[model samples]
Target: MGSLVVFFQLAGAVALLLFGLSLVRDGMTEAFGVRLKMALGLGTRTGPRAFLSGLLATLGLQSSTATALMTASFVERDLIRGRMAQIALLGANVGTALTAWFVSAGIEAIAPVLLFSGYVLGRRKGPVWLGTGRALIGVGLMLISLALLGHATEPLRNAPEIAAFLPMLDAAWPVALLFAAAIAALCSSSLAAVLLILSLPLPPGLTVVLVLGANLGGAVSPVLATSGLGVAARRVALGNLLIRGLGCLAALPVAGLAGAALTGLALPGAGLAVEAHLAFNIALTLLIWPFTGPIARLLTRLLPDEEREQEHGPRWLDDAVLKSPLLALTGASREVLAIGDAVERMLGQTRHAFDSNDPSPLAEVLALEDRVDRRQQQVKTYLSRLGRDASEEENRRAITILDYVINLEHIGDIIDKGLAPEVRKKIGLGLRFSAEGYQELDAMFLMTQENLRMAQTVFMTRDRDMARRLMELKVDIRNMERQSAQRHLIRLRDGQPESRETSSLHLDILRDLKRINAHIASVAHPILDEEGLLIESRLRMG
Candidate 1:
């Protein structure tokens, strides 16, 4: 019963720690996600800047894993180079250790003050205030959890079961390494694992081994998360893992000596765990940073890009199904959904290209636009062939699908001709949007992407509620675009340097995105019109 109670207490403390970390991550993202993304995207112009970006992003997010995943996504899109990505993650590794060190700085006494401040600030409005408040609250929670963790483990120091089990771990150091690695991997957080390890009363060498294991295991979560991002993403993540794995392999042989040297330092016991974490990453960064270029090249050869099949027309539209109007309409609906998918891809690639000031991704965006054009035409032609014998409702369904495909094609055109060229000009002329201007545009891009996805759902399901929600979001997008343009003009009036050459590009993008949003909102019309919900115009008849 005592053992179970102790286990529950430990688990609760760990859970609180993880929750605190998430709050910090979420708050930072909500407050400054755009600027952070831009820093990570643009900061890769040099290796050192890339490293700093990753380090700072990790510190703010309280999760190196999130930084890694974000970095992998950029690599996948070719917005950042593989070599720089590896270096950045090395920085992220150091950041994680720094976080562990900072939290262990004997300031748990201020937890209540931070908690109160965070709560008061959290109640305030605006992204910055709310985000800062949430982050402070998270920090306070983490500190409190650390105190609780100490209390929980104070008993383990006297527990006979722990005394026996810990010695068993000391006799078999490799087992201890794997045990800590497993804990970090399971928690998906090395900081949590290190803090937990800090609270325990382990032998000096064993404590070092556990920290090493935490570093090694910390690389696992990002690698796993990158599976869905793409091959380049996977490569970036896998590269980090291999680097850390190699470092661990070399360090494992000397854990005792390094542990003894650090433990020999006149520092306190809690400091030992954090110092081990910090020292390992610092040493690993110095040793590995120089070799990141060669290592990235090696990974490319080891995991060469998979060969893709030639692009072909409309995968979902089947002629055999044309005899059945129901099947034919369903296939067309699915085909339009696929076109929306392509459009989403185009927007993503375009946005990345703009952010990086690189025109390479625009080539894929063009290719995808062509694919979108071909698919939409096929959808239209297929519907034209649907027989007159079809019922009125069947004909109406065909028309609805036609309307959606046509609207989707308009979105494609806007992405292809409007946003793509503007982005190219912005990049080609070396024009930079003011930080405020760019943040506004980026927010619209994200909102439009989400609204596009929601529009797809509305078209397929024709759910009145989702349709209404999408329509409402369309209004929000328009308002956002208008507000952004107004802010850009204000910046211009004030003679903001960044607003000078990029004025036309910024306004053009806002207009195009708003137009695209208007088209996407049209998909909700039929569903809404059926429920007597859509207004023909906002104007009042005189």
Candidate 2:
């Protein structure tokens, strides 16, 4: 009964630690997600900057896994080079180690103060304050959990079963390493696993091996999390895993010497596990940072890109369904949805290219635009046959589907012809938007993508409330576009160098994005018209 109680206490403390980590991650994301993304997108111009970006991002997010995943997504979008991404992960590893060191630095005495301050700040209204407060609360809980962890493991210091097991684990370092790796993988956090190791009374060599195992498992979590992503993304994660695995293997035989060295120089109140974790990462970064390019090349050879199916033809349209107008309309609607998906992909790729100043992603936009053109033609031909000998409602539905698909095709064309070229010109000409101008355009790009998604939902469900919301968003988009243009003019008048350099390009892109949003918002029109919720015009009568 006593053993079970102790086990639950340890489990509960670990759970709280994980919860605290989550709160910190969520709070930071809510508060600074966009700016962080922008910073990451812009900060990878050089290897050192990329490394620092990853380090800082991991420090804020409190999870190297999150940092890795974000970096992988950027790679997929061609935002960051593969070599730079590897270096970034190296820095992220160091960041996580630094976090462990800080948490175990005997700071639990102020947990209550932190908790009180966090509660007060969390009660405020704005997202920034709330998120920062929640993060503070998480820090407090993490410190408290560390204190609890120490108390929970006190009984284990003298437990006969643990005494018997420690020798067996120490004797087989490989098994000990795997055991720690499993715990880290289960918790999905090396920081948590290393902290748990700190609480245990074990030989220095054994503890070092356990900490190494946690690092190995930490790298694996990102690879596993990104398994379903694109080949480029998988390569980034896999490359990070390989680096850590190699580091672990190289350090395993020397664990005892390293652990003893760390023990001798340990800071007052700092645990050996924390010291070892930090030292190992620092050593690994120094040793492997210069080899990132070769490692990235090796990864590409190992994980060659696979050819994906082209999205050109209509897969859902069928002649057998043409006999039933309702079934035909359903098939047409589904096909149009596919077109919408294609348009969304094009828009996303273009936006990514614009932000990253990389043209590699634009290749997909061109391919998708061609597919969109072909598929829309196919859809139009298929729907035209259904229009003959159809009821009024069926005819109306067919027209709606046709109109939506046409709008989607137009979006695809604008992305391929207008936005793609404009982004290419910006990249090719080495043009830069002022910070304010960049933020303005980026926000609209995000809003346009969001509106496209909402339009898709409105198309499928025809929900009245959603239709109303879409119409309102149309007004919001117009106002935003006007405001951004006004801001651009103000910047121009101020003679901002970046704004002046990209003046015409900036205004042209803004116009195109607004046009795209207008097309997307048109999906809500038929729904609103049917419900009498749409006004015919904004004209004033005398």
Candidate 3:
């Protein structure tokens, strides 16, 4: 009965620790404000920039995997080069270890004060203040949970059944290493194993080895995350694994000497263990940082070749990165841009197919639609996985991106199911647009393409001015569509193919073209309406 009670208590401790850390992770990201996005956007241009970007992103989100995944998306989108991704991967290792340091230092000690002040501020009903207050409340909860975990472990300190296991650590270090690895893999968190090891008064050598193994085992999460992702994404996951694995391999033989020195020179209260972990990560990063070029070459040789020339190109989302919702959302935006480009091409083909009566162009349009569908589904799945791993701020942004991408996919469907059908009907009827009507249709088609491009640009840059321009073009499209539909109706009444196929084809084509603009406008609205400026414009327009 005592053993069972102890088991429950230990389990509760773990649960509390995870919950507390999760809350703090989310709160910190929210507190960092929005500059993080711009930092991410600008940071991945080169190797060192990507390295700093990964560090900043992980620091903000409190998760290294998220930063790594975000960097992977840059590669997937061709925003950053693959070699830069290798550098970023190395940085994420240091970032994750930094998080463990924060955790071990008991940042939760100030939770109560933060909680009270946060609740007081939360009642004020201001956006920025409320967000800050909520973050404080999260910090408080995190502290309370950490306290709960510490109390839960108190029982194990005196339990005789577990006491027998205490002296078992005096044996070979590999036993402790295996135990740490298994614990970390099962928990799916390096912090979990770190805390467990920290709670025990194990020998210095065994403690260092266990922490090393814990770090290596934690890479399993990233490895598993890239299961169905593209080459760049897979490489990101593989890179994380290699860094951890090689770091351990390099440290394994020499870890004893370092651990002995550190233990012998220690100050007090298990502080040496934390210092040892920190020193290990820092030394390993320095060792690997300069050699990232060689590591990239080695990984390239070890892993199979990337299919860079694959049709529809690389998607930005990688399964390994879904844990960081902010990073994943960033990737989804890039993916949406790619899909938008493909849509513009399909629309161009549809326009030409209408005039040429060439099934070849129509077939090409269909192929583009199919490719967009695949990319859309890939992003959706990635977001769903990301939602599972994200903090609340990340979750909110992810939801927005997921909604936007799904909406964009519908635009692709409109071309496939709606516009394509109209073109085929016109061909079958053997009826053609009158000269003036053809010219008007051509103008509208050109405007639609421009609007699509503007929307993609606005999404990429989050430029309110570009979004405003897209809105203006949408209004122009509405007027042009109205005029074209009226002219097509006149042609029908004048006995110029009063046939069902001809009438339906002409009117439907105009409606689908206008609807496409509406979808683009929707995509642009999120960026523009982020501040009150776009809303003021809309009200004035109304």
Candidate 4:
């Protein structure tokens, strides 16, 4: 019963620590405008530079997982080379080691002072002190959480069952190392694993070895999370394991020296353990830092799989330089332009299907429509992240363009799936249109195609004049739809022999035509309604 209480107490401490770390990470990301993903875009041109970027990013986010995931994302997108990934992996290890040291050192002792100061400052009625105060509070809670965790573990030192385990830790350092690594991996958090090791009242040498093991296990979480990603991403995760695993191997002789030095250190034993942690990481970084280039090149040779070929399909829009918002915006615009081209081609194919009576062109239109839909999704995802760094004007522009492109893609789907298939069905059944009906249908198709083109133009240029013209064309197309539907009904009432199929085809074509007009009108909506139509629609009637 006593052991159970201790167990729950330890669990509560761990939960609090995890919660504090999460809050700190969130505050830091918000404070930095969440540019960790952008910083990771710097290709591994040089190992040192890549390492530097990784260090800064991990330190900023206070989570190696965040940094590694971002790096893996870059690798998957081909934004970073395999070699850069190797260097960044090493840097991430060093960064995570830094956090462990911060927790172990005397920094945690001053938690209360900082916590109270931050609380007072955080309540100030202005923006200036709020962010700094929030950051300080994050740091304070982070420190206090660790301190509480350490205090919670004090009873473990006196418990006979726990003390019996302490002898085993000293007797079987290697076994302890592997055990620690497994714990780290299963926990999916190196910080938690390190804190657990710290909570044990073991000698400093054993703790140092366990810390080393924790570092090795830390890479496993990201690896498992991103397994089956691109070869480059896999290489990055593998590279993390290689660097930490190799460091552990090289430290075997030093581990002997570490144990001796740790035994000689003063009372609390924290200072010595912290020193070992720092020295190991610093030495590892220095030694591996120079080999980043060779390791990178070697990884390239080992993982030489080609990307799936994209022919007239939406391409992945990842670039190392897109770490910058301006650069990312440029890439997004280029992708949007590609999507626009696909939309235009789909519309053109729809027109050709009408003119040549060829279903093949309509099939091609369906394929292009698929490409447009995919590209729209890709653009929106990239833009949503970019929105963090965007100015108000840029944000508004991005949302507007995305809105227009999404609608335009849907318009293409309507033509390809709705109108084209109806036409193909009629043609396959040997149904022929009357000369007058054919002329009217062709004219309506041409006008709708023109509207699609205009929508793309207004989206790309944000030209208010073009948008206005599109609204006028949208009204004209609606009139055309009404006229076509009425004429088809008249033909059916007149008992035309083919009126059944004709009416079906006419309604499908009219639906497609009207959908295109709606999409065109949507392009102008960023500047339209003249009376806040969206807001007014939600207003309560008096």
Measured by TM-score, the strongest candidate is 2
Question: Global lDDT of each model?
Answer: 0.87, 0.89, 0.69, 0.70
- Which residue pairs show collisions in model 4? 83-296
- Across 399-482, the per-residue lDDT of candidate 2 in tens digits comes to 899899999999998898899999999999999899888878877887777678779999999988667767777887798889
Score candidate 1 by lDDT.
Answer: 0.87
The candidate, 1 or 3, that scores higher on TM-score is 1
Which candidate tops lDDT? Answer: 2
lDDT of 4 by residue, 1-542 (tens): 87888788888877776666665666565445223544555325466788888887777767787788778866664456666776776677677767766766668767777777767877885333554466567777777767777777888888898778878777887887788899889877787678777667777668788878887788888888778676778778877777878888778546767767756754343555455556677788888877866776776687777764556544546655455666766677767767766776666666566655677877777777777777788788777777366677767677776776677677767777787787787767777765556656766765665566566677667676556667766776788788877887888788776666576776777777787778768877877653343343546888
TM-score of each: 0.77, 0.80, 0.59, 0.57
Residue 97's lDDT in candidate 3: 68
lDDT of candidate 1 at residue 284, scale 0 to 100 = 91
Better of 1 and 2 by TM-score: 2
- Worst lDDT run of 10 residues, candidate 3, spans 29-38
Record all residue pairs in model 2 with backbone atoms less than 3 Å apart, i.e. clashing: none
Worst 10 residues of 2 by lDDT: 33-42
lDDT of 3 by residue, 202-299 (tens): 66777788888888777777667766766767777787778777888788776668778887765433355566666777787777777777777777
TM-score-best of 2 and 4: 2
Error of 2 at 56 (Å): 1.7
